[model samples]
Target: MRRPQATPARVIVFGAGATGARVVRMLAESPEVGRVEVRDPDTARLRRTVDSCDDSVTAARGLEMPPDADMVVIATPTGTQAAAARAAVNAGASAVTTSSEISETRELLALGSLAAENGVALVVGAGFMPGLTCLLARAGAAEFDLVDEIHVAKAGTGGPACARQHHRALSSLAIDWRDGSWTRRSGGSGRELCWFPDPVAGRDCYRGALSDALLLVPAFEGVERVTARLAATRRDRLTAPLPMMRRPHPEGGVGAVRVELRGRRAARRHVAVLGAQARPAQGAAIVAAATALHLIGRADVSGAGGLASIRDTGRLLRAVADRGLRPCRFEGFTLSRDETPRP
Candidate 1:
């Protein structure tokens, strides 16, 4: 495990939406976290979010990043993530954000020099799919000598914000990395059967969003193909054009993320799967905390660089376990050519 740091005595969280509130709660609940300030234009929400946590939390106004904050978490809309992250790094605070598509990540990457100049790390995609998926892909990639393809699939029930984001994403084109470049397709295209754990067994998932693939392609060396899919429900499929009206799933939030890597390890065809299960918010908070803690620990490291999530696979998994996610909840298995049945 990476050494815990006392440097992030305080944290500043931007936005007071569903994910932001959860992030604040997770940080405030931590004994090591000193102070947590939540900012939002909605005064009532900011107050409610701050009040929900312990005395360590306070409500703040505006999007300004706190200079004293050791780390800043941007949980605002996907569109605003780049700007928020830029502000956080400029304010001299190491930062992480849950929202950022491939394009937005490019904008965030452009700020790498600024973050470096300020002597801080700026990490994007610190939430569940993009964050955890990125970490998991990297982890799975490490076990193989050469990677040929990568696929990630997720199933979960998210809140209103998540629903809206889903609606928006599905209403548009989803892209994936193939043949060394991005390939765009309809939101619900590329249907395939995906299996999760017990609760969410075999179900039809489609290539819903390509953001994870985008992050993986660059982060995972020598990957030719990267694909990410979202579990598609009947309602989700029908409501693709009108996402705002989509009905919520009746089941209590149970979700899973599985990463599959096909590569050569020891001169044999190797296939691997790495996965985890939790509520969307819970998973998001776990990755968010892990990213924040990582930056906090590296506060004094010189040279600024922007990466998606915790780069160290072992450290990332360890951090995930430390933050209430049991190792059993996250599963990994590998299969070799000799064990495979040829068609």
Candidate 2:
């Protein structure tokens, strides 16, 4: 008797814009992915994405998830993510979403019981900042005895949709987790100087209506303080309240995410900082692709949650690094014994 070969995975991606197209290309390259289909309402954009990929990939104009799809990766606009995710679960396919919008993330999380009942996994915020930043926080938290505060900051946007979201994030109200309570503040009010990895170094960041805290809080138990910020320019802040004046570039340039973990270790204070740099679209694609693969390949993963819900952070981070989004750690700082506080 001859041994049987395992079947390859079938993945459907919704949206063929910058991040979606890149996701399709990356999924097509994986040997585990047998068939890749990309769907977009825009025919021109769909055709361009399919034309750019290899022969194994196909294009469709419909947004519905096919029943045969093993996994559905959604890179559509933030507003449409919830509906698409529900469709994916209804079709009995695992789903991954790259949405960073707080409201959208909450909507997706609300589908947890539905997804769990159907035995499908729904991974939310599987993009650059919330995605990778979530992973970094989880990994860094493991190094400390007690994690007290987690601050995440990101610099840059990916495609036009991302740019628009970045603008809107600044204009919306910001949410922060402080001392066992949630507080709302003006998006651009809390200005802080943040240092990202090189190439995207030292940019002024401000509190934003980002989804990091919402996703991270549930994953880490008893963490006191959690805050998220986005890099912004003086012009960016001034123009945030108004509609975009001009068309955004087809794709933005280099982007980065910095995760800082503060806690105690062996009766002493310890801090760990990790960061990664890549084009926003590229980084998001890498993280999303890795997440889809992991979700599809594993039988143990189920339920709907953010990247912080991932059971194996090391495995996912290693896969992401393998795909070229290697995370870098910052070192060379010593804690002073008398630096606790001054009365």
lDDT of each: 0.73, 0.90
Q: Quote the RMSD, in angstroms, for model 1.
A: 3.7
Global fold similarity of model 1 (TM-score): 0.88
Off by over 4 Å in 1: 1-8, 246-252, 300-310, 327-335, 338-343
lDDT of 2 at 142: 86
**Model 1 lDDT-worst window of ten:** 301-310
Count of backbone clashes for each model? 1, 0
| Clash pairs detected, candidate 2 | none
- Cα-based lDDT at residue 130, candidate 2: 91
Q: Candidate 2 lDDT, tens digit per residue, 172-276?
A: 999999999999999998999988999999999999999999999999888999999999999999999999989999999999999999887777778899999
Give the Å error, residue 71, model 1.
0.6
